[model samples]
Target: MEDRKKDHIDLAFSSRLNGDMVDNRFDYEPMLGIHGKKDLSFEFADKIMQLPIWVSSMTGGTKRAGTINKNLAQACGEFGLGMGLGSCRILLDSPEYFDDFNVRPIMGDDVPLFANIGICQLEQMLQNRSEGELDELVDKLQADGLAIHINPMQEAFQPEGDVLKTPPIELLKKYLEKTDLKIIVKEVGQGFGKESLRQLLALPLEAIEFGALGGTNFSLVELNRSEAVAAEVYNPFIHIGHTADNMTHTINQLVDKMGYKIKVNNVIISGGISSLLDGYYLTEISKMPAIFGMGSAFLRHSMGSYDKLQSYVEKLANGLQLANNFLRVKL
Candidate 1:
């Protein structure tokens, strides 16, 4: 036992942390709050969640997608986090893969679970003037809202992509006018810019997810899938879009400018967030009620085992508890 303890100490001594660990806003003051007493729970989209980490939309419409979705739902149920399912457009025309998207039983009746669809799919529904199937999709899945993912670059790069006749903002505005379901506007991988963020903030949305640049650039995913010539032509666009930090600042500025009149009151900081610290910082910096999310990270964990996913979430919950007591965002 003594030898094992010495080996563990040696291993810890071999690893070194950098000076970048410093958060500019805080002092090394005496810790006062009891860790267990700190409230990590919050209300989002009419659902109360114990943590603010969202399992951002990633997979559906695949053979193994059921396992992944069910694993994620089970984790959210255990940890009290939120989930947004990947594109449910497949369910609109057919129920062939309905089980792939059905996860409410695993997730239980609570937690913010929303179905997702591309803007182009919604555009088609607008043209047909029938959102009956869409409403049914929500009702069947028992989702809290619909997340309309705006991904023009991804579509343009995809081989069988649909062209948009109108801009996403216009489509969203029109859809809101005629429908009553809750809406959440999100980017695919390229996060929103100042102007686009401004417009989305004006709407009464459940939340705005910063599908910022950095992690899983969907344009790059589609570009790689495209023919070599097409991939070369569209490669530059994969570098576009803002970061989560930039979007957080933009949301704060917009809220400041609009004061109390801004309709959107929540933001989901996702995309490039790779660690719990990034999640903590972005969530704290945003002026609105904010949650941090990850796709590839959660996807990697969920695709393996429920135990693996739960272990990851357990670390996150512990880190968040420590962060709430020790860290503060820079002004």
Candidate 2:
């Protein structure tokens, strides 16, 4: 106790925080709650996740992906978190990389595991009347559902990107008519605008993940892969989009105004959620059932040993529990 006090005294001067550094989003109520684990479990996509954390999709179809996915799935199983796999597009044409994305055995059947695919690929499948391939892919992986990521900006920037013959909204409206699979629509980085959100909310989607701006901008990724001149021309496009907080508030207002019209009842608050507090704040303020997801954060830890990934997820769970116990949103 004496040593702790001495260390606190020594660190006090350097630890002083000012106005801008203060997180004004929450009221830190020390008197109302205890510093102990609170039940954070919630039903999402018809499955229960012990922690409100989703390991956002990162990579697959590579030699290293098998290791990374195994590590991530093991962590999810141990921690009771949901996960979305990186694009399963490659698996549609060939089964050569199946093992890389085959983590259901490691992840178990309890928590939710989603298979991801791009909007363009789905559009092609629907056109070709090969949507059954999607079913086969999901069935083989034993994923709970499908997450369709829409990124026109990213596609436009890629040198060999697929050209969209029909608008994404139209394609989605058409595709929903055929599939019984629970669908989750998400942005790759550039989030949905108000109209886009409204349209999506009107659909019978399982969830809409805010793969908002302030995270990995796939448009920027494509630009970086392009020629220098082309990159410069399209650089400004990457900066356009909404952040997670902005989308959360927008959705809340939309829900207030168009209550019954909103069909999608759940959301995964992701993109630019840098820490547990960010996740807690957004999920608290959201009008719908929401959980937060992290991609780069989980990817970083998953690249190492399984122990490393487990430790990282443990910290996330611990921090989130502490936040839920004492912190309340200021709104």
Candidate 3:
């Protein structure tokens, strides 16, 4: 037993956190009694999430897409968390792949479920005056709203890419006029800069999801699948744009500067967030109604059985509750 203890101590020494991680994030207080998970509650997307985390969109119309979507929806319904479906582009043309995206029935009516579509598709709909198709997409999904994901970087590297014809924000202005569905504008990866955020915040967006640089930048995803020469040339673009923390801080300051001019009051702080502590820190510092989102992290467990996702969410909720009780975000 002593030998086992010595081996464990050696392993712990190798994995110990460095001094660089030290900061005034949480004030240690031993006197307060430990709290239970029941104490934590998060209200977002017009419903309360049992946990303060979100199952951000991923895997649509791909292999085992139906299974992935169903599993994610079940977890969302069970945990009281919100979800967004990946690009509904496949469902736009036919009902053949509709089962892959039709997860609203599983996520239920209480927790918010938003249908997603790329900016390229939205541009096409606008140019053609084909907004009816989008309206139908939402109706069929029984989703609360639509999230227009802007992905210039991803599209740039994607083969046979639909090169954007018009400026996205301008197209968004036109798109909003065409449909009354609730909207949240998000980046695909390589998050918005100050000017972009400023432009978006000035509009009547329901929320902003920072598909920031530190996360799985879809630019890199597309590049990896591109020709070797093209991938090498475009690789540097992946590092561009803001982090979740940067975006959150800029949002707070910009809102303060813009005040009433800012039409947005909700945001999904996502990208590169690997833990409940990260979510709590960003959510706590946010100036508006906020919910932290994760793509790969949620996707990792979501691809498996329902129990896997459920257990992951249970830990996140409990962790969030503990953080909320003992830690405070330093403004």
Q: lDDT for each of the candidates?
A: 0.87, 0.90, 0.84
Which window of 10 residues has the lowest lDDT sum in candidate 1? 25-34
Q: Can you tell me which runs of candidate 3 are displaced by over 4 Å?
A: 1-23
Give residue 61's error in model 1 in angstroms: 1.7
- When 2 and 3 are scored with TM-score, the better candidate is 2
**Best candidate, lDDT-wise?**
2
Candidate 3 C-alpha lDDT tens digits along 1-331? 9999999988996888977887676665556636854445566556676776677888677668788889999888988888988888888776788888888788888788889999999888887888789888899899888898999888989997888999999999988777788898898778999999999998888888998878888888899999999988988888888999899899998988998898875899988888778878888888877889988888888777889888988787777767766665666
- The TM-scores, one per candidate, come to 0.95, 0.97, 0.92
List model 2 lDDT by residue over 1-331, tens digit each.
Answer: 9999999999999999887887888888999988788889989888999998888887798888889999999988888999999999988877899999999999898999999999999999999999888888889999988999998888999999998888999999998999998999999888889999999999999999999999888889999999999998989988899999999999999999998988996999989988889999999989999999998888888887898888888888889888988888899
Better model by lDDT: candidate 1 vs candidate 2:
2
Candidates, ranked, TM-score:
2, 1, 3
Residue runs of model 2 more than 4 Å from their true location after superposition: 1-6
